[model samples]
Target chain A: MNKKITKQIKELVIARLEIMPNNMKVSIGSYGAFSKDDLKRHVEDEDEIGKKVVEVQMAFLRAIKEGKLYPQE
Target chain B: MPKRMLVTLPDHDITTYYLRAWGKKAVKYAEDHSIEVTSLDRDKANRKNVESYLSNLPFGMVFLNGHGDENTVQGYNNEPIIIAGKNESKLKSTITYAISCSSAMNLGDASIKAGAICYVGYAQDFMFTLDESNSTHPLEDKLAGLFLEHTNIFMSAIAKGSSVSEAYDKAKGSLRESIMVAESSGNRTILSWLLWDYYAFVAKGDISSRL
Candidate 1:
């Protein structure tokens, strides 16, 4: 929420997206498909799509932290 | 009485292109099962055609594939076909499955309130990764398959006489399996998106409703 935290998350998301293969593209509903470099640019710009990607990555990290990805019986 | 199904596939852009290609599998499964299918494809996937079909036909299942938001599902060239407050009543008595983004949040609820037997869709953005090399041949893209195949499984289960809840469970189960596969293969990109989709999938109205 803070400016410092926001910048940190942006960097984290960009780093995660950077490892994606160049040939792959992500289609996010009406936002259309985005390539690896395109995603990094979005994150760097902190546009709507960039915020969305950051939200997705944050949600994923939270899920993992809560052990929701693989719940025990 | 014979069962009937209606599907809309709008192929005006790259995103819709993949949706149209994958949506064909559901249409084919319906045809193969002797279910009468009325597909509004390409330019025909408009509000007028969708209204005419729903108003006159007794289709038990409807599959809408295109771009969408919380209140509307677009058709050809992003034409609003089914708007929540305006035409959701047209879905009454039908089991509707929308493979678009975020329509499940509002339109799905509106349709159910308008008497739709059931509704299944994503509450948030329906995201997927595509292999650009297979852009010209979407069905052959294994990366995209990790996401779209679960949707196909849901529609196929419905066509096979599975109840709405049953079909939803089957799709979720398949997604979980795919997630495990992605993790085992150390594909974090695929795993993250798969998890996002799995969480986004939601169903409303009567879960026991079946075609």
Candidate 2:
């Protein structure tokens, strides 16, 4: 199968869900586990990870709504 | 055929926490799918470790769980940054499945610029609902099963020569469908499954040629 650019655009749409300021980097997590395989060869699980992103977005939105901050690039 | 290895990673914020949800699930799912799986917990392992592992492996799929910001993916070993570059054709080109958000956001164009097959997890963070049940099995029932479910579906789709998008949508959508139907909002079990299911993803691309 071909590596599709459409896949990234699809993820970009999801990235839009993040209402974060440009400088404010959204921190994810470090699931403590071990791997022998090279880290370079990983396929992203967008849908599942995207779910948590939505919640983070929700949090971002809540922060904005409270006038805590605003969204930037 | 080389043995399959499932590599699990951690995002930034949660990497410090000790939990088997990420690592154990990879093993269980891989076993179910006849793939040999292992995890690289945060700080304990790193890219060098992966290099060693890759050197010994025959060939298979690679699954990553961690914090994927923009162009680079943050792995363990105390913020070991893994850059996705022209190495797509390198390391025998193993297909990747990232459990972190945004790894595939630009269609993996940034990281896989050279050429690679990867399924990245993209979506809003709210999508992953943690298991709050506070019970014994934190993974066996939900996490491992969730990955296994889509993995099986993805293999089926790939066998058909389906495009990456087609296969991803097929497997992802189906995973969503099953979660919606289950709708058991009991303690941590179903809720956590529902939450996590909404986030993760499996990238499309036949990296086997590279490997």
TM-score value, chain A, candidate 1: 0.85
Q: Per-prediction fnat values?
A: 0.74, 0.05
Cα lDDT of candidate 2 equals: 0.44
lDDT of 1 by residue, B105-149 (tens): 999999999999888999999999999999999999988998999
Candidate 2 residue lDDT tens string, A1-73: 1333245544543444322222221223432221211111122333433433434444444544775331110
What TM-score, computed on C-alpha atoms, does each candidate reach? 0.96, 0.52
Query: Worst lDDT window (10 residues) for model 1 chain A?
Result: A1-10
Evaluated against the true structure, the overall lDDT of model 1 is: 0.89
Docking class of 1: medium
Q: How far is B39's C-alpha from truth in model 2 (Å)?
A: 4.2
